[model samples]
Target: MDFYLTALLQGLCFSGIALGIYISMKIFNIPDITTDGSYTLGGVVTAILLTRHLPGYVVLPAVLIAGGLSGAITGIIHTKLKINPLLAGILVMTALYSVNLTLMGRSNLPLIGTSSVFTFVQLVNNPNQNTFLILGLIVMAITLLIGYLLKTDFGIAMRATGNSESMVRSLGVNIDRMKIIGLALANALTAVSGYLITQFQGFTDINMGIGVVIIGLGSVIIAEVLIGWLNITSVWISLALVLAGAVIFQLVLAFTLNIGVDANLLKLATAVFVLLIVSLPRLLQVKD
Candidate 1:
């Protein structure tokens, strides 16, 4: 039971990234691989700020801004420079590797003695429940903000731009601007996940973002499946399911571990899980 609880916390930690991917991929129809780099960027920036004894409030905004900036760059390259979105993400992601390494001045940094938001939570509550509460609140607050934003006029424009770029452009809407803003918003959310995960886990590694995009993709895919199956139409409910999907993804991984799957094969298993989720719907539709 305790082991499953830990996995639940882990899923909450990655919920922000899942939301980010949902915005960029599902809403904007763009494969922004920059998520991989931005996730680590958030962690590295947060670790350094915390190591310098900065307050959590300050540390969080810094991580968010840094993450947003990376996303904006990818957006500019794709929208302004006419580069393919995939290639632009690859370019920024490649550059961010060096940027993250430079910020950390090492391959990894441990927050052995540093104070984080989690530390405050730990001080105020049971150590065992600290992660559950802190991560849960953080993700919930962000989810509300995003859910509200997605229903606004501008937000509707962003969604329409994704669904019909030519029509959005014909309507006097700036399609490029929408894409840029959408991508920036997406990466900013992804960075939040990185920031919290670093603090929650007590360390930040340069390679922490490795395969992170896959995790986010898998979570979104899982939620999408559930959303479709349940005929959920409310944007708020849809977003919440995405967050729940992240938890479900982690729980599945934990279950596999409990069954004694080799640790190194976990990534392979994740890929297979995502593939199955993505394919099953189409197969079912065909059968119907």
Candidate 2:
């Protein structure tokens, strides 16, 4: 039971990245691969700063800003330079590899003695409350803010831009700006998630972000499947479902581990799971 709860909580800590994926893929209709790099960028920056004894609050905003900046560069390349979105994301992600390494001054950063928000929470009260409670609150706050933003006029413009860039341009909306905003915001959330995960896990590896985008997409698909994907009537519910799905997916993996499944094959399992979920709707329609 403890193991189950721990995995669920750990899954929640990374839920922000899942929400970020939802924005990029579902909301913006863009397959952003830059998340893999930006996730490490956040973790590296936060870990480096924490190692220098910087305040945890300051590190959080810095990591978020760095992620946003990296995303903005990708958006500029895609929207302004007329590059393909996928290529732009790839280029930016590749560039971020060097940047993250430079930030860490090596291939990894360890937070052996540093104080993080989670540590502070542990100090303030029940040292036994678990790091997940703090992470859960942060995730809830981010989910609420994103949900509220998606309901506003600007959010409508963002959705319109995603649905039809040419139409948004014809209506005199700055399509480039909207794209930049959406990508930046999406990656900022991803970076924050990365920072939290590094703190929670006590280390950051440069290679830790590899395949992160795939996992995030898998989480979104799993959530949509579990929720029936029919009444995606509001952004809040969508975000909530994504988080829930990620936790459930982790639980499944934990169960597999318990059954002596080889961890080396987890990526294959994740891919198959995503494929199944993504195809379910069309398959059901055909059956009907």
Strongest candidate by TM-score: 1
Query: Which whole-number lDDT from 0 to 100 does residue 31 have in model 1?
Result: 98
| C-alpha TM-score for every candidate | 0.97, 0.94
Report the alpha-carbon TM-score of model 1 versus the true structure.
Answer: 0.97
Mind giving the per-residue lDDT tens digits that candidate 1 earns over 13-105? 999899999999999999999999999999999999998999877988998899999999999999999999999999999999999999899
Clashing pairs in 2: none
lDDT of 2 by residue, 1-288 (tens): 877876787688678788888888888898998999999999998888999998877898998899999888989999999999999999999999998888778898789888888877663465436576787788888888888888899998888888998898899999889889889998998898789889878999999899888768878888777667566766677788999877877787777777787989888877777788789988988999
Q: Which candidate is the best by lDDT?
A: 1
